[model samples]
Target: MPKILKILQEDHRHHDILLSILENQVKDAHLTGEPDYDIVSAIVDYFLTYPAEFHHAREDKIYEKIVARDASAAEEIGHLDEEHEACEAFIKAFAAALSNVLGAGIITRSQFANAALEFIESQRRHIRMEESIFFPTALRVLTTEDWASLDAELSDTADPIFGSQKEGQFEALRQEIMDWQSTREPANDHVPGDHKLRL
Candidate 1:
């Protein structure tokens, strides 16, 4: 229940919500033959605003410090860092693919679907690793002083993506994400015969 862990956990909650929204959108796209650009844009915005900016910043500056300070975690921390880099690469590639489709409409819907699925799958695994392994390791390794410093750093860091209105912008983003989640029914709710979870 350290402050740093609390903040990171909150950030993970947002990530989960966003992932759910993306999953819902993908399901809708598959069923209705409709591309939900709004949802796609929202996911991209989250990468730009939260994951790429806030989450990466905290992990690199704060969490990395804890990992570096702990000699016992050196190998595990190195692996985690590589995974983080891979996740970032996937995000960038997904964003580029989305932008290409949106801009030129050259990529077919199936192609977009495939790309999005890859992104989602990679992200899902990455999140699981972080939540199950990385976060727990961080909690065990970092001391009170480390946690306090992380909290302070997080508080002081201003989101360049949102400028001076970061809080207001985040509030609006949160509401939009919540609204989408509320309105969309799960694909499984209306599945035809003998539907099973694929992955």
Candidate 2:
């Protein structure tokens, strides 16, 4: 596996954990009637910034090269860039909904819950598609030279949450990830029913 792919997979792992945390928080909010807006905001803020700024761009670089190397691979790749755009839109819309919830505006708990679950499920599905379809296609078709070119061309941007220089701004969210990781039993990459909420 190329280093870039490994990094992307690691990013997906971190994202899965965060999504689980978000799911747990959303469930709690549904039950308690009081949402932990700060934590929720932190998770939303992290998604809004990190994945767009660093993660997807890296994947796009690789995906572009794969298509150039083999046009047939394009079918497997299949609108991933558009999906990235959609993911960004998801985060932005979720952030706006979160703002409304925080302000105690017209957004109902049902609306907020729907937005949160949509973002979480969309993200999980995207990652799964990339891992299943995209990454394997890249590995099969891309030559050693291709990997070398991609490795040289790609920038080494440290992830804000999981990277070595972890940002202090994400301290609360980071702790939530850690606590969530510690408590959960080992499970498959695809967490079935994890996103289900009581509404």
Candidate 3:
């Protein structure tokens, strides 16, 4: 497996764990009638910034090469292109829903709940599809030359949350990640309905 693909898979693992956490928090909010705004905001911030800024861009960059190698691979990855856009839309909606729930705007509890659940479901489905379908196809088709080209074209960026630097914007997200990591069980192996991802 290439390093770039490994990194992408690792990023997906992180996203799965975070999405699980967010899903649980959303459920909790329904029961308590008070949403964990900080956590919700943190998730929104993380998705809005990290994945949008880096993860998807990285994937898209390599995907361009993948298509260049095998044009049919383009058909397989087509949904993901739409999914990337859908994800952005969901993030925006989730953020706005949170704002309404937090009293900065006007959103009903049911609306917020619906948005969170929808976001969680869509994200999970996207990850599962990528893992089950998109990745293996790329691994099978892409060559050493393709990987080398990708590696040279894309420079490494330090992760603010999982890496050395801690940015102020991700303060809440950092705490949530730390808290989840400390207590998170081992074994990222996916069994049916098991959402924990090995850090």
Candidate 4:
């Protein structure tokens, strides 16, 4: 895999963690009568801004090169641009629903749960599709020279939540992720030097 693909996959992993956190909050709402709106807002805000601005843009650039180089790959890749747009739309809808719940308490628990889970599942499916089909096709079709050209064209955009420079607004979410990871790690397992928490 190209370095870019590795970065994208890492971003997907970070997103999965966020989705897990969101899911937990939704579940906890059943007992508490309300979710943590601040956490929900932070997660939604990150989704609304990050992927559209950085992650998907990079994928679109690479996909464009793939289709240009091998027209046959287009059939295999399907319409990724449309998928990205749909993902963004889902995020926006989810954000709006969250806003409605926060501002007016108009949305019922069931309705909010449905919207949140749909957003999470849809994002997971899109990531799976890209990893299983689009990414593999790129590796099979795109040349080293193509990757080099793409590397030159793409910006090394930092992930505000997971990157080296942590954004202040995301501090709580970052700590949540770290806490979540700690529970999953073995008692004696060594933390990787490059782990996000360490950074």
lDDT of 2 by residue, 91-187 (tens): 8888989989878678888898999999999999998898788888989989999888878876767877778777888888777776766677765
Top-scoring candidate (TM-score): 2
What local lDDT does model 1 show for residue 196?
19
Tell me how far the alpha carbon of residue 132 in candidate 4 is from the true structure, in angstroms, after superposition: 0.5
lDDT of each: 0.65, 0.82, 0.76, 0.83
Candidate 3 versus the native: TM-score?
A: 0.87
lDDT tens readout by residue for model 3, 29-124: 768977677877888888888888888888887777778888898687775677789988888888888877777687787888899888888788
- Where does the lowest 10-residue lDDT sum fall in candidate 3? 190-199
Candidate 2 positional error at 35, Å:
2.6
lDDT of 2: 0.82
Model 3: colliding residue pairs:
none
Task: List clashing residue pairs in candidate 4.
Answer: none
- For all predicted structures, in order, the TM-scores are 0.76, 0.92, 0.87, 0.91
- What is the RMSD, in Å, between candidate 2 and the native fold over all Cα? 4.7
Kindly indicate the candidate among 2 and 3 with the higher lDDT.
2
Model 1 agreement with the true structure over 1-199: per-residue lDDT tens digits: 7776665655655565566667777778878987677657767766765676667667767556665788677557556567677877877777787888779757777777777778777877776766777777787887888878877766555432223435543454555565765665555221122221111
Model 2 pairs whose backbones collide: none
Worst 10 residues of 4 by lDDT: 186-195
Superposition error at 121 for model 2 (Å): 0.8
Residue 47, candidate 1: C-alpha displacement in angstroms: 0.7
